[model samples]
Each structure stands twice: as C-alpha cells, then as structure tokens.
Target chain A: MHELGIVFYIIRDVKAAAAENSVQRISAVVMNIGEVSTVVPEYLTDCWRWAADKEPLLKGSELKINMIPAVTQCQDCGQEYETVKYGKTCPHCGSGNTFLLKGNEVEIKEIEVPNN
Target chain B: MDKVRVIEIKKSVFAENEQDANALRQELKDRGVYLLNLMSAPGSGKTTTLIKTINLLKDKLRIAVMEADIDSDVDAVKIKEATGIQSIQLHTGGMCHLDAEMTRQGLDGLDLDGVDLVILENVGNLVCPAEFDTGAARNAMILSVPEGHDKPLKYPLMFSVCDVVVINKMDVAPYFDFDLEKCKEYIAMRNPNAKVIPICAKTGEGVEAFAQWLLEQVQTLKH
Candidate 1:
C-alpha cells in the first residue's frame, strides 16, 4: 500500500533530523493525521512497524497517531463547523458557499528521541 | 544512576513532499504548461475519457499524457495508438498513487518544448491519489455510471478536493440504477464549487463541453 511509501518518508526525515541533532536512538514518532486524510492510522502504524524495525535507529520505536478533527468555514456567514457533520454547506447560514479550514493534514507533529 | 531525556521536534510528515509540489507548481506555471491530474477507480473509463479529451483538444492545443499504473504500458500504448500524441508510461513499482516527486520525474522524462498541456493519468485508485497533490494546476475525477451514484457519499474526500467531477458512461445511464441528479446533488453537498459534467466517452457525448472548459483553464494559465 501507499502507507509503506509514507513510512519510508517518515524514516528518511527522522533519520536526517536525528543525524543533525546527534541523537542516537529514536523512541517514538508522533503523527498528526487529520480526520479526512486518506491515510488510515492503523495501516500507517502497521507499515511503520514493518519498515521502521528494519532501521537500527528505529528498531522497536513506537508510532503514535494524533487524530485531528476536520473543520469547515462558511464564506457567507463566516462561521466554522465540523466538516464531517455539515460537509460543504454551512449549518448556521444554510449556505453552500463553504470551504474546508482544516483536518486534511498528514504531517509529522513531533519526533521523540531517548535522552540518556 | 541514569536519567532518560526526551527531545521533541515538531515537523510535518508531508513537509518535504508539499515543498516539492509547490516548487513544481511554480516551475510549470513559468513554463506555461497546465498540468491536470486525472484520477478515478480502476475501469472507470479514465483512459477512455482521456483519449476522448485528447481527440477533442489535440488540434487546438499541444497536448501530452503521462499514464501511471502499478505496472505495464498498456494505457500509454492506447493513448498513442488512438491520437498519435506523445504518451509516456510511468510504472509506479507497486505503488497505487503518484506523489509530487513521482509526477515531477515523469514530467522531466517528457519533451515539453511546445506542449502547453500535460495530463497526468494518476493510478486508478480513489483514496491515495486524492491525498497527494501532484502539483497539477487542476484536479479532475471521473466516475462511471457502472460505479454507482453513492460513490460521492462513500468517498467524500475525493469528491471534496476535485475541481471537476466527470460522470462518464452516460450512454448507458438508462439501464443502470444510476441517478444523474442525485449524483450531482451528492457532489454538490461535498464540494459546492466542483463542476459536474455527464459524459459518455464511448460516444463522444459531452466531450466538447469538457474540452471547452479545459481550454478555458489553459487560457487562464497562459494569461
């Protein structure tokens, strides 16, 4: 699946950051997965476990996912509402002139390293 | 006695990919090539619609296509045989989707000297392709009648992010239980601004209108 490709990216970035900071062992990688993001958290972690374990620095490292709620903004009413609940229409104004404000991200929020 | 210290680094996982996508967008904008990322489920007439689109616009504008798949050059061959346009096949090596970096590499392989339009036929999958922005100026998705009308409801994110939604295989709309109006309503609910065009690539119906819309977009980019 594409999750493996994403896991590789995470590994590459984490390795680069670790080398720069002179950190030897990575303890966990935190991800900010939005509610609407296509990447399934379960599949991502499953792929991460398989790929991350192969790297010495990431062997036994944990993958933590932080779910972000999707929100939409109404251009007409200037109101913010849950994207999953209301979709493109703003519930308050009943206007179809709306756009997503957040919750489509698939980003690394933090990378944790063991300090000894 | 030893103490464990924790170092926290906040960064986006897609930062590198998004940066590459933005750079590629700027590069394409400078070159005046309007790249369109086309996505849909497998066997949804994506290639058929693309070929039809090429036939409509090949004479009006310089056009090329990059057919991406998990493997094989089947779709690429079809494009060349149908329109005689330059078609390149990108084997994703088992990946179901094309990211910005992959799209950049595919474009680099092509000779865009006089070409004003380049369409990236992304791998036939609804989920992953929608997640990654391939630096296309616009994103279009095709949904065949046989695929059913509830797809917009099932895959809300895909419908939500697209600029245009093409309902292909309209010629056979009578036989199937596909509701044209209902489908449009679903798409509108998810994406208010998305343009929905009902087309039958087999019969060339509604292809001209779609081509006109595409030309307008290309013209906008040119100016």
Candidate 2:
C-alpha cells in the first residue's frame, strides 16, 4: 500500500538526478533497501514497474533493490546481532537494551544511463 | 552504440523530505504556529482524542485542524462539528502518508496569521507515516488498549519517532490483556523521552492530563 507512495519519491529523485547530469534517459535505478525499512522490495518493484513506465525518463528502466541486512547493537555487552532474527533482545547477552545499527535504509544508490 | 554507465548518486530517499521538514519547522516557528503531527493506526481513537483535546484548549489557543486521508472529508467534517473550530480536509490522493510537501500544501489552505496551533491528523497507519517527516513542531501518536502493548516492539520506528504516546481506551484496558505499566515500559524502551499519557477518550477520563500536556506544549513553543 505504502510502496506506491515510495515509488513516487524514487521517481522524483531519479528525475532530479537525471536533470543534473544532462542525462536524457535512464537505464535503471539502483536502491539500497534495508531489511527493517518496512518497505517490501517485491511491492516496491511492482509499484515501480507500474509508475516508472509512465515517466518518459524512467520508461522501461528497471528498479534494482540491494537488500541490506538489519543489524542491532547491544549497549550492555557490546555485541551486534541480526535484527530480524533476534529483534530487540540481544541474543548473545540477552539484553533488551539494544538498538538498530543499520538496515533502516531506503536509499537511491545510483542511476544507470546509456551513453553514446 | 549505447554504453551503459552508472552515475553515482548515493542519497537517502527521505533526505530531501527531511530537509524540507526542517525548513518548514523553522518557518512555522518564525510565524509562531506550532504544528502537531498526530498519527495512529486506524480505529485508534485519534479523532475522538483530538475532539476532546481541542475542546479543552480551544479557548486558550486559536487552533486549526487538517485531516489528511486517502479520500475523505468525514474526519474534517467530524472535527468541525465536534469542536466547532477551524478545520479542513487534505486529500492525499491515495498516498499512505503525508510528507513535508503535502503538509506545506495543507498549511497553505488555512489562514495561519491568526492560528496559534495547527494540528494535522495524519493518515491512519503506524508504518509509513513514521518514515516521512511532516514538518510538524512535535509528533504525537495514540496507541489504544486493543492494539496490544507489543506494538512498540513491532513498530519501533513509529514509537521512536513519536514524542507523545497517548494510551487511549483506558476504560477498556481491564477487558483487554493490556498492561498500562508494560505498555509504558515498551514505549520507554523504544523512546526514553516519549511522554506517555493514559486516557479514555470515550469516557473523557484522564483527558485533562492529555489536554494540559498539549496546552503546555503550545505555550512553551509559541510563547
């Protein structure tokens, strides 16, 4: 549901990037999606396929997602664990005082453009 | 012959929105209007809580409400009739959440010169709403008793982003397996600074505390 909204943002950013580089058309847009970012990559791709086709710059351009694994750090015992597998509780020391270190990203990594 | 080349443009998707939200917050501060972005899951009593709080503070503050939804004026209408204050609806055009740009557009529709406090009823959803910054002076959310205390664990981003977590439906807490203390603990675990105010919006129990908290916030920010 929210993935469609995210698709619009990606398109806007991709367009801006295209304009900055004087790129007439884009080949593909690569994104860094996090495991805990709450954005389903499949839904995002589906929405991208629908919305990207409408934009002339993004028409036929693929949206590539690079999945970033979520990691959590425990303050009590200075240990890092997988966020999706262990959650808030630290598996090593069993501490609830844990925080996410990464994997909340929905970032546009790069844009592939066809050059003559 | 067309050679495929990669243009390095590493940027967070929300970076632009975050910048816009910061700028909007500063602008609102300069204009002396406190924008409160209220969010919650559907059926979490956000409208009811707003009605109760607006009625309490409307006398002290000139408030305006913006109801953001995919498509509906019902919340906007309900707010206008219940509080008898200035209220307007913002259609998100099927978007799950309102970004800073949408919020700015919504604010443009209202007369901000005389308005001291502007409360934006963000679209109902705990997930996407928390991800986007709406340029509000403060962010608050309602977590009802029926939603379970584990919501904070499930939706850490939402809990972490909210400044205030209003525990609505306290009257029905006994009927549900909701532990107020445990809920507060989970919220604290997620956000150490988040203020938790328990209230029963239906029975108007403990609403004064929530109202007073809001009043003090507006006074502190606007004054």
Candidate 3:
C-alpha cells in the first residue's frame, strides 16, 4: 500500500526535475534505499512501473535502487557494527545503548535522461 | 543515442514532507493549536481511549478530532455522537499513511477558531504511519494487551518516534498473560522518555491520567 504512495512521490519529484531542466523524457530514476528504511525495493519498482507509465514524461522509466547497508554505533562501548545482524544490542560490549549511524535512507539519488 | 545526462537530486523521499511538517508545526504553534498524532494497530482501542480522554477534558479545553481512514466515516461519526464535539473524517484515498499535506487539508476543513487542540487519529497501522510526519505537535500510540508487550521490539521505529504510549485494555491484562511491568520495560527500551499510561477504556479506569496529560500539554503549548 505504501509502496504505491512512495512511487507517486517519486514520480512527482521526477516530473518536477524534468520540467525544470527542460528534459522531454526520463529514462531512469536512481534511488538510495537503506537496509532499514522499511521500504522493500521489489515492491517499490513494481509500484513504480505501474504508476510511472501513466505520465507521458516518465513512460517506461526504470527505477534503479542502490541498497545502503545499515550500521549501528554503540554509545557505551564506542564501537560500530552491522545493524541488520546485531540490531539494538551492540556486539562489542553487549550494550543496548546504541543508535543507528546510517542505512535508514529512502532517498532519490538522481534522474537520467537520454542525451539528445 | 544510448547516452544519458544525469540530474543529481540526492533528496530523501520524505524530505519535502518533513519540511512541510515542520512548517505546519510552526503554524500550529503560532495559532496556539496543539495537534496530537495518535497511531496504533487496527484493534488497539485507540478510538475507545480517545473517547474516554476527550470526555474527561472537554470542559477545560476546546478540542476537535480528525479521524483518518482509508474509507468510511464511522469513527468520525462515533466521536461526534459520543462526545458531541466537532469531529471530521478524512479519507486517505487508499493511502496507508497521512502526510503533513493531508493533515493540513483536514485542518482546513474544520473550524479552527477557538479550538485549542486538534487530535488526529491516524490510520491504524504501526508501520506506514510511523514513516510519515503528519505535522502534529506531539505523537502518541496505543498498545493493547492482546497486541502483546513485545510490540515495541517488533515496531521499534513506531515506539521510538512516539512521545507517549498508552497501554489500553488493562482490565483484560490478567487473562492474556500481558505483563504490565514487562510492557513498561519494553516501551522504556525503545524510548526512554515515552510516558506510559495504563487504562481500561471499557471501564474508564486510569483515563484521568491521559486526560490530564493532554490538558497540561495543551496549556503549555498555548501559553
């Protein structure tokens, strides 16, 4: 349900970028999807394909996702580790006092248009 | 020609929405309106708790409710009939969450004049609603006994983002193996500052605390 909503936001931003740059058509929209962004890449592209084709400027445009690895930093031990594997508990000192360093992004990296 | 030109955006999908939410928050503050975003799973007794709390504090503060759902106005009607305050239903049009713009549109439909607090009953989902900022001054959630005490562990982001967690269905906690102490512990783990209030919305036990919390929040925000 949310994937389709996300796709709509992407299309809106892409269309705005295209219009501002005077680009006629978009070939692909690259996204930086984090491991813990809660957005599944497959669902996003599936929704993107359905929603993007409705607009003439984004017909057949591909959504390329770049997965970012999640990392967590332990405040107690001053160590960083993989968020997916260790979660809130820091592997270094077995401390639950930790915060996510990154990998929570659902960012649009760029838009690509065919060079005329 | 197979050659392409790239337009660097490097913007988060929620960036614009977050900005809008902040702007709306500023506007709400300027108008002395305290907007509370309430979220939870579908059967978490959010509406029940809300009804109880509203009745308790209605005399002290001028309040309005905006109920957001994928369809139907049942909750809105329920609130209006039960509390007799101004309540409006917002149709999300199949979206799982309500963003800042949707919240603003809902606020526009209401008569904000002389209203001190606006409570937004967000779509009942722990996942998607946690992702979007709805421009509320504060965020709260309800966790029922049947939903288990491990909800914070499962839905970490939702717990982390919430300012308060209301533990509803306390009267039935004995039958369901719902450990109130463990529930508070779990909520504390996710959010150290989140205030937890145990209540039985059915029997109207411990609802005064929630109502008091809301009253204090509205007073602080307005003053």
Candidate 4:
C-alpha cells in the first residue's frame, strides 16, 4: 500500500544518481528488502512497473527485490535466531531480551544501466 | 555489441527520507517545537487519546495537531471542535503512510507561530506507519485492549520503534482478556526503554500521567 510512495523515492534517488554518473537510461533497480520490513516485494514491483515506466529514465526498467532474512540476537543467551520465526523471544534460551540484528533493510543495492 | 553494467550503488531506498527527517528534526529543534508522531491500529482511539491529552495540557502548552488520513477531514474537524486548537487535515491521496516529506508539507500548512508541541496523528496503521519516520522528536503508539495482547509478538517492528506505548481503552479490560503485564513484557522484549502507559481515553483515566510524560519529553527537547 505504501509501496508507491517508496517507489517514487527510489525513482527520485535513482534519477539523481543517474544524472551524476551521466547515465542516459537505467535497465533495472535492485532492492534489498528485509523479511520484516513491511514492504511486499510483489506489491513494490507492481507499483514500480506502473510508476517507474512513467519516467523516461526508468521506462521499461525492471525492479528486482532481494529478500534479506531477519535475525534477532538474544541478550541473555548471546545467540542469534530467525526473527520471523521466534519473534522477540529467543528460542534457544526463552529469553525475552532480544533485539534485531538485521533484515530490516529497505535499501536499493544496485542499479543496472544499459552498456553501449 | 551491447554490454549490461550494474552500478554498485548500495544506497538505501529510505536514505532520502531519512535525510529529510533528520533535516526536519533539526529545523524543529531550532524552532523549539517538539513533534510527536502518534500511531496506532484503526479504531485504537488515537483521536480520543489526543483529545484527552490536549485537555490536560492545553493550558500549560501551546498545542497544534496535524491529522493524516487517506481521505478524511473528520478527525481534523473533531479536533477543532474539541479543543479549538490549530489543526490541519492531510489527505494522503490513498497513501497508507506519511513519509518525512509529506510530514514537512503538513507542517508548512500549519501556523506554528507559538506552538510548543505539534502532535501528528498518523494514519491509522500499525504496519506501514511504523516504518516511516515523520521527523518526530518522539514516536508513540496506542494499543487498545480489544486489539489483544499478542500484537507485539505479531508486529514486533511497530513495538520496537516506539518510544512509548499507550494501552488505551483500559476501562473495558474486565470484559477483554488483555493482560497488561504480559503486553508490557512483550514490548520490553523488543524495546527495553519504551515506556508503557495504561490509559482509558474514553474515561480520561491515566491521561494525567500521559500528559505529564509528554510535558517531560517537551522539556527534554528544550534543554
């Protein structure tokens, strides 16, 4: 639902970067979406296809999402576990004191431009 | 012969928004306006809680509100009728959440001349709203009793980002199976420093303490 706004942000940033690099056209934009980031990859791509094509610089550009697994570290046990599976509690020690280590990324990892 | 080249940008999609949020934070800090991004699920009594808090602190502080909704001026009207404070309704045009730029636009529409605290009642969404920073000095969320106590387990990110969690609608706790302590434990698991305040917005219970907390946060921003 909020993917369209994010898509616009991505396009803006990509356009700025493309201008800086003197790139005429971008072929694809790769995103590193985290497992728990609330950004649905399918929705993002759907929105991107609809919105990105409107921009000449991003027309026909493909949006690829790379899913990053969310991990949580338990404070008491000092062990990491899958955040999506165990949530805030540590499965290894049943400890509630835990924090996310990664997998909350909503970043653009790479941009592919047509090479001539 | 054509070749495909991939640029190793490795930049965050949220980087722009983060930068905007940080800039807005600095601007607000310079102006001595403490911004609070208030979020919650639909029907979590965010408006009621805001009204109650306004009533408690209106005399002590200059207050303003920006109500963000998909397409409704209902909340803005309600806020005006209740407190007569400066209020602006932001129509997100089908967007589920307000990013920092959108928030800055809303702030631009407001008359912040003497406003000490500006409360942004974000669109009623637990998932998307938690993901965006609205350049608020403090992030607060409301969890109603009927929403169940297991919400933190299911939506850990929302709980994790919140500075304080208000357990609203506590007046009906007798009818619901919501466990306050258990919910607090869940919140603490994700964010140990998050303060949990139990309040009934309808009855104004615990609103004074909530107001006090807000005052303290505003004071902290002053220093």
Q: Pick the candidate with the highest TM-score.
A: 3
TM-score, A chain, model 2: 0.98
Q: Write the per-residue lDDT of candidate 1 for residues B24-110, one digit (tens) a residue.
A: 999999999999999999999998898988988999999999999999899999999999999999999888889899999999899
Q: Can you rank all candidates by DockQ, best first?
A: 3, 2, 4, 1
What is the C-alpha lDDT profile of model 2 across A4-103, one tens digit per residue?
9889998999899889999999989999999988899999999999999999988999999999999999999999999999888999989889888999
Give the TM-scores of the predictions, in the order they appear: 0.88, 0.96, 0.98, 0.93
Candidate 2 regions exceeding 4 Å error are: none
Per-residue C-alpha lDDT of model 4 across residues B72-115, encoded as one tens digit per residue: 79999999999989999999998889999999999999999988
Worst 10 residues of 3 chain B by lDDT: B1-10
Predicted candidate 1 versus true structure: per-residue lDDT over A11-85, tens digit per residue: 989898889888889888888888977678899999999989999999999999999999999999899999988
Each candidate: chain B TM-score: 0.97, 0.98, 0.98, 0.97
**Which 10 residues in a row give candidate 2 chain B its minimum summed lDDT?**
B214-223
lDDT of 3 at A114: 89
What are the RMSDs of all candidates, in order? Answer: 2.9, 1.4, 1.1, 2.0
What is the docking quality class of candidate 4? medium
What C-alpha lDDT values do all the predictions have?
0.90, 0.93, 0.93, 0.92
